[model samples]
Target: MWKFTLRRILIMIPQIILLSILIFILAKMMPGDALTGMIDPNVSPERLEELREKLGWNDPWHIQYADWVGGLVQGDFGQSFRFKMPVTELIGERIVNSFWLSVATLIFTYLIAIPLGILSGRYNDSLLDQTITGYTYLGFATPLFIFALVMLWVFGFMLGWFPTSGSVSPGSEPGTFAYVMSKINHLILPAIAMALIATVNTVQYLRSEIIDTKQKDFILTARAKGASESRVYNRHILRNSLLPIAAFFGYEITFLIGGTIFVETIYNYPGMGLLFFESITLRDYSVVTAVVLLFGVAAILGALLSDIILSLVDPRIRIK
Candidate 1:
């Protein structure tokens, strides 16, 4: 396990390096200049040149990328063009919001998906199974932004049950329970949007695994031994069947980060998604590159964590 883990970490080094290079090239290739968003009509050409020089934008692309990579190694993510703050600080402030939203979405999806999947699998071909199948199809078919809009209209516009946007109510002091809960209230729409898209695939994967497990010889043996139905299903079947679901959970987390980009834009929530959107609009290369790298690291780490968990659970996955 240690060897495998070390190997995975080693592999990630080049992956990160490649991602950095790609982001650098992409940022450079983007049509607009970073200073385009910052410059005003009144700003003179000399002043703009001075600003570009100050930002090191006058340097060759390779030199800039090298400096950026070096600073990244030292934990300096560079300053944001839009916010005029360190990119790390900008990302840090928004990460918790994104993290909590993702957590909420995960909890919501898993709580509903696992049971629905189990029931669908256990009663395969029955009406209940058909119903779950229909639901899953509906979830998978609907686009995330559309779902978000519908949810916002129903929950926020018509019912007035939750706030439509923002992380927290403005002017609310941090660290207060009310403030935290209020932020969670704003999160509901986006969370549901995220969960709906995720739940469809999770249900399909889990249900397929459970149904397959049910037909295995060991399951038949357990039944022949006069094992209780619940024991056969939950203890033997679910225990083994959950391996795929466990793997899917990690993949789902990575997917959620990507989905959050669209969800956040629709709802105007202050998270990494919103930051990424803003960075693109403002041509904030530092912020854009930092966010891409951050998400890339998160995805790699999530996969690594999942592999470790799988190795622990299934003896077939040898340590070495």
Candidate 2:
């Protein structure tokens, strides 16, 4: 396991480097630039040239990339022109909010998906299975923004059951119960919006897995040995059936980040997703590069973690 892990890490080094290079190139190739923010209609050409030179925008792409990589190695992701702060500091604050949103969405997704999927799979061809299938189809078909809007209109505007936007109510004191409650209330709509999409995916995967696993020779053997159906399922089939779902768990981490952007934007929650959107609009290259690189790294890490979990769940993976 250790050898496999080490090898995976080694393999990721080149991949990460190539990904970073691509991110940098894309950022540079964008039509506008952060220097636009420094320009005024009255600003002279010479002043713009000076600003460009100061930012090393005058340098070749390779030189700029080398400098960027050097700073990245030293834990400096560069300064964000959009916020006039260090990119790391900006990311730090937003990533935490995004992480919590993702966590809540993940918990909600599994909590709803797994048991429902199990029921649907166990009672296949029954009313419960048909109902679950219909629900999953609806969930899959619903556009995230439309769902978010409906959530906002019903819960936020009409019923007033939940706050529509932001992580907390204004003037709510931090570290207090009211603040925490405010955060959760504000979180519900967006998290649900993100979770709904993922729930469909998990339910479909688990339902299929359960159906396939239950038909295996081993499951039949256990049944023939007089093991109760539930016992056979819980003790034998469940774990084996979960291997693919475990792999999806890793991909879901990155999926949540991408989803968070849309969800957070709709809810006006301050997180990395909203930040990415704002940075792109402002042509904040530093923030854009940093966010893209972070996303790339996250995706790679999630895949690697999934492989490790797959190995643990199925020892055959370790052999391969």
Candidate 3:
């Protein structure tokens, strides 16, 4: 397992470099530079040239890429053109809120999806199963932005049960239980909005996996051995059924992290997603690259974790 993890980490280095190159290309394709808006209409050509030189925009693409990579190796993500701050610092300022929000969404999504999925599978074709299936289908069909807007309107505007925007209320006291609770309160709508589609996908996948597992020869053999229905379900069916779900758990983290863009933007939450939106609008290449790299790393890590978990849960996987 340790060797596998190390190997995966080693593999990630090249993947990230390739992803960085792609991001650099996209950044170069943008119509203008960081100084495009900043330059005065009457500014002398020499002054503009000096500014470009100072910003290293005059460097060859390969040289710029090399410098960027060197800075990345030294733990510097470069400076954001729009924000005028180091990309690392800008991301650091926002990542914690996004991380916590994603965590909360993951917890809520699984807590709701798994048990309902189990019951739906256990009573396949029943009214309960049909109802859950319909609900999940609705979730899948709904657009995330539309759902976010509706949730904000219904819960925030109409009922006023939750705050409409931001990670927490202004002037929230730090290091207090009240502050924590306030943050959670502000998180409810966006988290739910983000998790809605994910929950449906999880439920649908688990239900399908469980149904197939219960029909397998192993399950039939367990039943023929005079195992009680509950025992067979708990000891055999459920355990086997969860292996795929467990593997998917890691990918779900990646999904939720990416999905946070809509939720955080709609809610005006101060997180990576919101920052991503703002950075893109302002053409902040450094920050945009940093954000993309962060998401890419997360996805690679998630996939690696999923493989490791699958191997652990099913010995056949490890042996193979």
TM-score of each: 0.95, 0.95, 0.93
Report how far residue 147 has shifted in candidate 1, in Å.
1.1
| lDDT of predicted model 2 | 0.87
lDDT of 2 by residue, 37-148 (tens): 5646788878888988998998999999999999999999999877999999999999888888988999898888889888887788899999999999998898887888
- For model 1, what is the alpha-carbon lDDT of residue 226? 97
lDDT of each: 0.87, 0.87, 0.86
- Residue-wise lDDT of candidate 1 within 189-227, one digit each (tens)? 789878977898888888899989999999999999999
lDDT of 3 by residue, 152-250 (tens): 999999999999888888898999998999999988788888877788988988899889999999999999999999999999888888777888888
RMSD of each: 1.6, 1.7, 1.9
Weakest ten-residue segment in model 2 by summed lDDT: 311-320
lDDT of 1 at 140: 79
Looking at candidate 1, the ten consecutive residues that score lowest on lDDT are 311-320
State the lDDT at 56 in candidate 1. 86
Candidate 2 collision pairs: none
